[model samples]
Target: MKITGIETFCLRYRMPYALTYPRGEYQEREAVLVKVHTDDPNIYGWGEAAMWGGPFSTTTTVLEKQLQPLIVGQDPCCPEFLWEKIYQETYYHGRKGILLSCLSGIDIALWDILGKVAGQPLWRLLGGFARPIKAYASSGYYRRDYGLDALAADVGKAKSAGYRGYKMKVGNLGAAVHSRVLHETPLRVSFQEDIARVEAARQALGPNLDLMCDATTSLDAKTAMAYADEFERIGVRWFEEPTQPENISGCAELARRTRIPIAGFETETNKFNFAALMDAGAIQVVQPDVIQVGGITEARKIAAYAQMRHLTFSSKNYSTAVSLAACINLLYALPNADFFECDADPSPWREEFLKSPLFTFDDGIVQPFDRPGLGLDIDEVALSQWVVQP
Candidate 1:
């Protein structure tokens, strides 16, 4: 069916608990959701470009003012062709960042529409893989009044909730609290204190459950190497974005020096950059966000490349339910799918925005929805409360 109309919404929802990273503290999450209406009766599709800690208006503008006008009369079934069409048309404006983020949302919506037309679940439609993917509780962010003890308790609660693995945030605020001093200083934690926190989490999680750490691109190669050595001792499954995302060579250096797998490229937007990272022996485990990496179309290409290179392909999960659903569909099709990242943080946006049941963990395993398309029914009433007027 031909495309009829495209609608975009910018949403902002306050979080239950504010999280601190190297950049700063975030108390709210933002997202840009897109709805693609087609000529066929009762057949619309949904997609989202979630800005975990970034601004949403710019991407929303790109979708409404630039990309939407071009795709209204085109065929919704040809996602790849449409993706390339948008990319090439927008290349003069730049091929990455906000532009790609907007294109990604639209691409996902097209795939959702295609799946609905075919009367098949997206995972089956994509590749027909039958195995369930394992999910790791991705929580343990640095909270306002919380310390190591609080972190340990959080880890314990996640384990009790049936999560078989956990990923915690590190490199928070670096060595100092003041922004000016932080710029002059190195991005690193107080070594002994950071080790103590990991020790507490390790003690709480026990040795059986898998553990991972994300530095959020804060530490330099030297500091990351030191952290990697210590994390390997504590049995951390992988170290994520230890240095700045642009530092491909630095990430490569860190990977070469340590046995722990380097997992990153969540900030990346194209396949060419991913190829560079892969060729440099930089990341053993590649975490591509479907919403940020040009939706399932581009993510499938990256997964195939990772599989060919014998690397682990996992997703960076910390966005809207739509993003999670898209990731589950994509991950289900890949044989190298390692662990699905699910935000362990409590937020109404994550739990209450969708009418469909949020993914449930059964002994740390999560199965993709069997319904056609992305299998999500948006809560329009709740969405109205968070929508921002342009």
Candidate 2:
């Protein structure tokens, strides 16, 4: 079949609850979705990249102006070639962040289209592996009122749901919240706290629970080492992004001094940098964001590379359900798939936009989907209702 047309939509949906990560808080979600259609009379494949805003961020503008021109007439099935072409052409103008993020959405869509064209599911197309990927409940955002009770209930809920574990956010929150989570929760709990607070949290949470500190590109090598030192006392498992993503030497140094597994590169765009991160001798866990890391196509390659090096494949998950479902599909395809970062916040807009809500989590485990090509359909009505012109 020949190339046809690519349609792009930018939608903004208000969140049902506030989404507060370490960086900031957002009440609404803005996403850029691409629909690639051909004249060959088949279902169109869809890919979405929800851009978190800032200057030079991944926005709809990046998708339309920087990326569309490069791949409009290109064959959607030739994702590998198209991915390289877009990366090379945008190297000068939009290389690292937004450019790659926009291209990631297109690249994912292209792969989806290719899979449909070949009449196979995305996992099968990418070389199928049927390992049950463990999902960790990432709830705790909504329980701000109940705090420990919320944390305790959610942990219980996740374990009851069948999840092996859950992740609780830790910051400079006082000892009250920390005590309840570390002492009360029954299931294995993981903590995604800042590097600065990891030691204190680990000491409070104790040795049994898996403690991980996400520096979120916030710490330098020295600070990372300090956190690592504290983590050693309490036995934290991984130090995520102790230094900046570009600081390969700093990461290497931290990894050398600490026994903790260095997990990072969630913001890294493609496999080239991923190769560099692997080479850095710092990262033992690869955390690639499906939306930012070239969607399923590049994610699979990155995961494969991590597995080859005996690194754990832990992906960053917390977006709309469509992106979450896409990540799960990719996770299902991998052999070394580790914990999935599950979002516990309720998103009304996200739910309405999906053709079908993904498999619900039991305790903390989500059932693998057997449907073709991510198994999600875009709700046209919801899309139209939330469509953004600017």
Candidate 3:
């Protein structure tokens, strides 16, 4: 069926407290959701695009005024073709930023439509690699007044909340780019402070559960390598974005020197950059955000490459419930299934915006949806208040 229309909602949610990563702090979280209507009014698909670390309009403008127009009359079943068309048509200005993010949202919605048409869930339609998978608690940001004791208490909650893996921020007080690019300074922890943070989490976690570190593209390979020894000592499951995405060689060097698996490039765009990371041995675990990258079409390609290269393919999700649901399906579909990054941040988008939970965690293992398409039942009324009108 042909795509008839595309609707975009630029959503903004005020956090109870500022959430800080090495990259920056979020006083409010924003995401752009897309709904693609097809010839059959009953068949529509939902998608979410990460708005970079900037204004929502940056991506929504492209989704509404630019890319949406290109695909309105096209076949929804041929998402790959439409994705490429948008990419090629906007190549000069849109190679690696919010434009690709907009394309990602459209592509995801199109795939959702296709899955509904075929009466299959995206996981089964993609590959159905695993029905149940492990998930990691992605918490422990550098919040104001969040001391070591507070950090331990927060991590303790995640461990007791039934997560088998945990990832916390590290190495932001030193060399980093967020302040320069993101327009503000964020709470940063030194390597020394980060060590204490990890130690506290490890103590709170009791050592059996896997613990990971996200440097958030803040450290150099040398610094990362130096800290990696301690990370391995503390049994860090992996090191994520050890350095900036541009430093492919640095990340490769760190990956080679450290025994801890180096995971990265969530900030990266499409398969080409990921292929370079793989070819250079820069990353042992390929972590591509479904929204930052080119949606399912590109992520599936990266997963195949990861499978062929004997690497782990994982989703680095920090977006909303729409993306979380999308990534959940993607993780189950991956040929190389690994841990799904669950945003431990409490928000209405994660629970209240959805009509029902997309998946359930049995003990600590997360399961995928058994329904058609993305298997989403969104509560639009609940979502409406967060929607920005332009």
Clashing pairs in 1: none
* C-alpha local distance difference test of each model: 0.83, 0.68, 0.85
TM-score of each: 0.95, 0.81, 0.96
The alpha-carbon deviation from the true structure for residue 198 of candidate 1, after best TM-score superposition, in angstroms, is 1.3
- How well does candidate 2 match the true structure in TM-score terms? 0.81
lDDT of candidate 1 over 1-390, digit per residue (tens): 799888888877787767766666667777788899999868988898745545666777788889988898999999999999999988898587877777888999999999999998888888966588877899877666787888899999988988878999787644432446556333335767777878899999999998898887877788888889999899999999888778889899999999999998798887887888999999999888899888899888988899899998998878778888888888887888889988877656666878777455688899876888887878889879888874
Q: Give the winner by TM-score: 1 or 2.
A: 1
**Candidate 2 clashing pairs?**
158-363, 158-364, 161-362, 161-363, 162-362, 162-363, 163-364, 163-365
Models ranked on lDDT: 3, 1, 2
What's the number of clashes in each of the models? 0, 8, 0
The residue-by-residue lDDT of candidate 2 on 298-322, one tens digit each, is 7888889998998879788776666
Error of 2 at 301 (Å): 2.6
Question: Which window of 10 residues has the lowest lDDT sum in candidate 3?
Answer: 174-183
